[model samples]
Target: MTIPKELEKILEITKEQNTWRRKETLNLIASENVMSPVAESVYMSDYMSRYAEGKPYKRFYQGTKYVDEIETLTMDLMNQVTSSKFCDMRPISGTVANAAVFRVLANPGDKALIAPVQAGAHVSHTRFGTLGALGIEHIELPFDKENINVDVDKSIKMIEEVKPKFVVMGGSLYLFPHPAKELSPHIHAVGAKLVYDAAHVYGLIAGKAWSNPLDDGADFLNVSTHKTFPGPQGGAIFSNNEDYYKPVSRTIFPWFVSNHHLHRLPATAVTALEMREFGEEYASQIVRNAKKLAESLASLGFKVVGEHLGYTKSHQVAVDVRPQGGGAKAAKTLEEANIIVNKNLLPYDGPEAVSNPSGLRIGVQEMTRFGMKEGEMEEIASLFKKVLIDGKEPSQIKREVMEMRKGYLSVKYTFQDGEWEQKFSSKVIPMII
Candidate 1:
């Protein structure tokens, strides 16, 4: 049988991306990660073709006997990793999780305080994103330029003055730990809830490198599975405040999510278990690699942000690429060289500068999972220098990029060759043909 032209094109494009991205290029995208082989194996199960509209063991649909068990197990693993009493994995993305929590805590006309953009507030926390859509007024807390973070004292004052229903913390372009411990009390003092979006640093928290927001007095902690955590793409919300559970869980169902994407449960469970065993080692190396990459880039004369504060404590490095023709140009150049990074807004830039922002945000998590360390970070820095600084032709530099990517193809810090295939997936997942 002959394939249609459009279908053949789609298949060819898929093959090209698999070769080019998975096998050849260096991926530095901060908000992304790859799952391990075992996790991927389980993720391709029959769950994709099914639905379980409600909580495990309490489904709205039939044929959900196995769904209840897997979803329950997945929730248990999530609770263990995050050290929270209540967790819901119904939201399909971090933004949706944020939306459900935001709606549950604050009414449509209510006011909410958030860390300012420069201090690393994710878009979901801003008036331009979810909050705006919900009709809640989003206010930015004070930022301390000297510390490169939220101004705790000033923000406390703002919390009192604004009387916001909730306070939002965390970021898409994060570096150091936020003042969650310091701000959570003040937020509560004003009868406000503290919501921490730990999407970018869930693995670090599980590994015990970063403080868990719930322990720091945050009422709720929200996360996505595929950032530094290296799971399938999915979201979850965790909280120690049991009072908020029923309402928030209901909001997640009827308000924000429906079927809940059943396939994510198994894959997420595998990743959670991986973090339980190897999170500390994996998270620690991520920070080390990030710092090394920052130091290396700075040595090559790139203006790495937070230099005086030791670059970064997480798996991220922010660079001011203005001198190298700003972030958009620099990122495009590096992509041409098979090196990936994203254009990002810096503290000094206004919202108008988003299209041609002044900085580049880089994450070391994926490469860290691929087993690259300090020495490899230095090598990567040289590749950046060759493409962005020394003015080398990108096609020539891509050859070197592909060479470096060769040895690091195997994923680390996981049950890479586990028995999930023989024990479960073989029985559960059909061949799909």
Candidate 2:
């Protein structure tokens, strides 16, 4: 019994990445998270090999009874967590979720207002992405630079003037809550629907650490399950509005998605149940850690954004890294030191700055799941300063970073037993192999 050399190499690389990302490095990428061992185990089930297209109990394929039950359970858990009357656990990714909603709500030539790219709108909401593919006219909502949110008065005026088919709220670089409450009434008055893409903060809302956009008058809530939600890599749409349920669900299957990745259902269900139990504490600590990280970075002369608004209410913190050779260079340099982050466009960064944006987006949710706290956030900021400000060698910083990560290797706030390695070895890895 011998493994092929090429296959061996692939396994080696995956093992390396698993060890590097899971054990050694500090992940600050705002869009990333680690699933709990229980969820991870479920993610590797035989369901991965199956397909259950269309909705539960009505599938295009047979032999889907259990799959249907799992999906139904998952949707039920999603409804419970989101407090929405209807939930669809289908769209394979966040962008796909956006596409389904767009397909149902707007015609090809209809106008849709979205948060500006500089203000954190995901590409799916812009002309360069899905909206463009659908021939929908995408317009930017006015952004208030000093406040780091939508220009409510101007946006309301724009909504009246343009009268778009729908207005999209929420974005990837979200800091504070959007003015959904303020603008929803205005959006509806103009005969437009309000949609919130809560991909980054879905878990926060579920945990009650942030406001639910549905509660703030949004007609639909879309999310990617992987980010702060700590589920499988998939997407979901939730809403209380009965009118949207049938159309949106049908659009999701025959139009935007097929098969729907049945494996994600049980994993998502487990994560949803876990969130119901530990999400409040996990989400609260994530925000607290983010605020502390922002303050520490600002104190270290990093020009952290949104200081006047108490840094952040979510899991993210943004820093202007132009002073230390710009975000592109700074992010790469941090990676060399085993600290992961992504370059992002600040509101002031023009379209030309997309390739070399002046800002870095950092999220503390994964680390918070690893049981790191406010004090640890300060230490992480020091690591950033050493690498970016002091111009210390990244190799030197990497050693210290690895040492610092030694104690906080276990994933917390879930129903897993013992240290992460022990739990993975005894429970997840054995089951998978």
Candidate 3:
């Protein structure tokens, strides 16, 4: 097929420029992941043309019969993946899933306990988030420095004192597994419901890497697909109880969104099914990679957050970068060398702005998925130390990064004997290292 002159020029530019850019950037962002070729293929299908406006059974637009199937399949996959009685795939992002939970569970003035953003809570549940703006009282959870987990005793005291309407657990930078089930009884002592934000650990849980929040007695659970789940960018909500279905569906539909992209649904559903089969392997590898990276980084005299395995029960590893000019300067210095990471705030950070905090949060998910194991992590950490500790030139580091990335040909996951599938396979889940 001959390409038209006009489209050909655009294609040429896209192929020459953006393609290489994607190839070069070493994505260590904890919340991001490269979707399988199969997942990407589904996004570009005819389903993308649909404009369904409601749930699977009913819609405001015609030609939604197929979209209905896609929605149902997505829901079923989410249920299986999370083991929830009610799972809704309508929320466009994890934030929206959380919003839906807040809408259904808390009144305008009701108090909702959450971890402070500096303490590693996501914005969705923080006082800086929608929860605070919508008249929902925000109570920040405390962490135990010795154990690096939520201080359930302190939180229980706060719950009794505040009488919060809902108690939220989990966050973006939480390295340790949340004791939601054990803590739920304490929250209920003050008539509060437990909501677990499993965004970071969804893939880990599916991989049997960490315990599931639902099984741990959380009433509500919210997660994003792009993180450790290794799926298309999307969000999902699952509940231990079926009664939340209607309220959640309502909050997601007319109240929060309309015509939830049918194209994204099929892609997300396919990703979910893939996760159900191969997620355990993928997720376990992520943890193993993180563990290796943390150990390597710590061995280099870097201040790693959790010295123990359970302290970082998932993929994230946070390092205090203040000794090396804080997170902002460190991030810029590293980025100039073609290495990417984000500045973050630690629990004990004494008043650093969110944009320019004192720590660097790193992850091994992308590298792990790309087939880089312990040795590679050690190499990356050595590079990191050389650049930061040895004071190597930023440009010199970029050249090294370019060479390092070249060794890994592509980001796509491969199957048996190079017969690579375009999407994730639930059965291909990797074992924990």
Candidate 4:
């Protein structure tokens, strides 16, 4: 049978995106990452078509024995990686993980404390998103803009005054670690649970490139498996306290998830095993590249944030791009040059600045996974200067970007070396019958 024209066009577009994103471009998006070839291969398994509604070895459906074993292995690996006593691999996304916890811990009309949006709280933690959906009232934690963290003393006072049911730490725009150790006692004294949203930095934590919230007094750690973790896209909930395990697990199913995405189990297991072996090295390089990139950008006259704190301690680096036509315009320009980045809200920006905010949030994890290091970070910063500061045409800079990308195509920190090219080559090209 002949392939339909529209279907062929779809295949053509997929091919273009795969080539452009995976091969030709420098992906610097903080919330994005590439799965290793082995993980990706397992991600495309027959498990995608099946469902296992409950915990391992116990399910609402049949033919889930293998699924049970795989999930159990995945859970064990997750616990080993995070050093937590309990883990739930069921939440489909980080937001779903947050929702599950919220439903389990708080009732409607309960007050919750969260880092302010400007300070990096994800929307899911706000009253406008998941928290609001659960009918929880969320108050912003006091932020110390100069220090770029939660104002510990002020937040403690607010916690006592409001007595929220939960206090959420960690965020999407995070640059430094929150004061989890400092606030945990105060939060618990007020009968509030400490929830750390490690969605953006869980991989960094696993790699030992960042602090583990579970070790720092967080009662619950919620995370997305992708991003800096370099795994399949999914979410996991972890806690050192086993007392809260049953309630959290029960809430994940029958309330938030049913099938729970079986395909990601083996892929997640592969990633966990990879992290156990290579996470430290990968994470160390990621932070070094981020700091080097920030310094290079700052030297080139870009307004890199956190200058007072030595730029950054994680894979993320934010730049105030208002000088170069604001973040939205600058991000679009960089995208045209094949240097992918995202517009972001800075601490000084108003809530309304989200659409065309003052900053660009760049992460080196994906590029670091592609084997680009500190020197490559310098090259990337130079490219940014050319397009944004020197007023060069994006098309002109795109040639250099592609040339720079050519040498860094292979993914590192995984079992298979140079296997992504072989695995994806045929899939990207349209199949003609």
Candidate 5:
């Protein structure tokens, strides 16, 4: 029997995207990463066709014994890597994870303080996203323009004045660390809980290259299992406080998520083991690549953000592309040249400029997953210069970009076949590298 026309079209488009994204172009999107073949193989198991509601041992379904084991193992490995006492891997996405915490931390019409939008407050933490949908009042903390971070002194004052129910820190396009350590106390003083959205930096935190917000007194750590973590696309919430975590765990189930995407558990477990074995090197290289790329961009006359604070401690590099006629133009031009990055809003950009802003959000996590290091970062920066500053033809640069990409297509920082097969059968979690 011949394939139907619609099915044929869908198949064609799927293959095209798989080839283009995997082998043709470099991916610089801060929010994406590739899963390893080992974990990916585990991803396409019987779990995809099944369901398991509620916790591991106490599932609300019957055909869930294996999934229950997989999920519990995933949570245990995640907890081991992140050093959290309580873990909930039920939220299917980072936003959902944030929503669960936000729900438990405050009621509708209640107030919450978030990191200044200019300094990287995720939309979920603001009145424009989940907070608005939930009817929570979101107050933006003040920015320290000189340091390109939240103004701790002013934020403390605001936390006291508003007496919010929760305070959110960390976000997209964030270059430096949020002041979680300095502001956690003030957040608690207002009868509020501090939440750190580590979605962007979870890998770094677990790898010991970045600070764990739990140690900084934050009540919760919300994360995307992907991103710098290089895991499957899912989310988990972790906390030392049972009161906070238990409620959020309940919220994740009956409210924000239902199926919990059973397939993600085995894949996530494999990724967590990979992080335990190789994450220190991978996370360290990501930071080095970000800094090197920023320095290279600066040398090429691109305005790299946070130049005074050593460019970046995380895997992201924020740049002002206004001279190249704003981020939209730069991002489009780069895309034409087979380079991938996103147009983003700078702190100074008004909410009205959301469509096209002065900033470009470039991340090293994906390229780092492909094993591109500091030297490749410099090469990438030169390609940016050639495309944007030198007015080189995009088609010509696209050829060079493709050629460079040919050398780095396979995923790195993951288990080799022989190594993983042995580990996959065992109950032991690897010691952190």
Candidate 6:
């Protein structure tokens, strides 16, 4: 059968993205990862044409037999990866997943105990987040700057006083294992459900590299597939308590989300199963690389966040750049040299605005994926010192930055295979340059 020109044009457009993939630079943002090849294939597979709403194997629309198998594998893989009793692998993203959770759990104006956005809380749990516009009240819990973990005593006291309906246990930045076991009992004492947002550390938890909130007394868990977990952009919610199954699914289906994205579902399910196989080695190395990088940056006089033991036990590290200039300027300077990192707010900022804050967040996942290790982190830290601390010209550092990046060419993905390296031959659109 001859292919239609319209479908041919769409394929050409996809080919353009394939062609341009290699020119893109570093993705150092904390909440991102390179998905596996099987995940990538299923993502762009013919399943994209189907619409399988409702639940797996049971669809309102027709032609869902194969798609049903995909969804079943996705949910089962999710269950295996996190050891959860139940899993939902379709919220579009982590932010919207939290929105679904709030829809099921809270009413308008219901108080939510959460750490502030400026204090490393994910955007979904703060005033500027999805829940904020939904009329949920937010109560900020103070954190300990020294340890970079929750001040459990202070948080519990505040929970006792506010008695919020929900308590958010996870933050965007993690330097140590959360005291979930200690905090969960307190939240329950005040009749609050602990909703653990594990978007940043889901893979680590899957690999047993970090604390498992579900086992530690979290009533519900929300996570993203991209960060830590090597999957496409999507969100999920799971619960051991059977009561949440109905309300959570109802809110996600008819209330908040209409039809889940079928294209993302198959890829996500495939990636979830891949994580079950290769996630331990990858997740462990991510945390180890993070620690090494943090230590190296600190040794270079960069004032990296956290203190002893590299100030982190996960896949992220933050450096205080305000003494040099500030997070915004430093980020822009680094970007000029083809290095990418984001400006973030530190808890001790006292009263700094969220935009263009004082701290810089660095991630080790992508660099680790590129096969760079502790020595490379040290060399890169020196380069950072040259630009941010020593005030050298960015142009001088740019050459070295390019060389370092070039040296760490694409390594073989244990799970993704060689599809990522296959460059597209045809470009629908001409090169921009």
lDDT of 5 at 352: 88
Tens digit of per-residue lDDT, candidate 3, span 1-433: 8878989898899887654445665668788777665676567767656688877778888887878887887888888877777888878789888888888788888888886554467888976787976779887777776776678788778878988888888888878887787688888788778888988878888778898888887888888888888777778888877775567767788877786666677677767777777777888778888888888988998988867643366788898888999889998898888778888887677554667787898877877777788889899899899888889998998888888887764553423224444343433433232
lDDT for each candidate structure: 0.91, 0.91, 0.78, 0.91, 0.90, 0.77
In model 3, which runs have C-alpha deviations exceeding 4 angstroms?
1-17, 308-311, 411-433
Look at candidate 2 and give me any clashing residue pairs: none
RMSD of each: 1.6, 2.2, 5.1, 3.1, 3.8, 5.2
Candidate 6: tens digits of C-alpha lDDT, residues 1-433: 9999999999999887543333334557787777654566557766666676788766788888887887887788889889999888768788877888877778888999886554467877877776687889888786776667778889888989999888886778666666779889988998888888888888889878886899999988888888888778888998898897668876787666667777888677767666677778778888888887888888888888777645788888988888878889999998876678888887677545567778888887877766777788788788888888888888878778766676665633454344423543232222233
Residue-level lDDT of model 1, residues 241-301, one tens digit each, is 7898778988888788888888899999999999999998999999899999999999999
TM-score of each candidate structure, all chains considered together? 0.97, 0.96, 0.90, 0.96, 0.96, 0.88
Per-residue lDDT over 1-433 for candidate 2, one digit per residue giving the tens place of the 0 to 100 score: 8989999999999999999999899999999998887888788888889988888999889999999899999999999989899999899999999999999999999999998776789899999999999999999999898888889999999999999999998999999888999999999999999999999999999999998999999999999998889988999999989897679988987887878888899899989999999989988988899999999999998999889999899999999999998999999999999999999888788889989999999999999999999899999999999999999999999999999999899888888765644645554443444
Model 1 sits at a Cα RMSD from the real structure of: 1.6
Off by over 4 Å in 5: 417-433
| Per-residue C-alpha lDDT of model 5 across residues 58-129, encoded as one tens digit per residue | 988998888878888888999999999999999898899999999988889999888888988888888889
Clashes of 4: 0
Q: Model 6: residues >4 Å from true position, as ranges? A: 1-24, 350-352, 411-413, 416-433
Clashing pairs in 6: 37-416
Highest TM-score scorer: 1
Identify the superior model by TM-score, candidate 3 or candidate 4. Answer: 4
Q: Which pairs, if any, clash in model 5?
A: none
| Residue 158 C-alpha lDDT in model 6 | 91
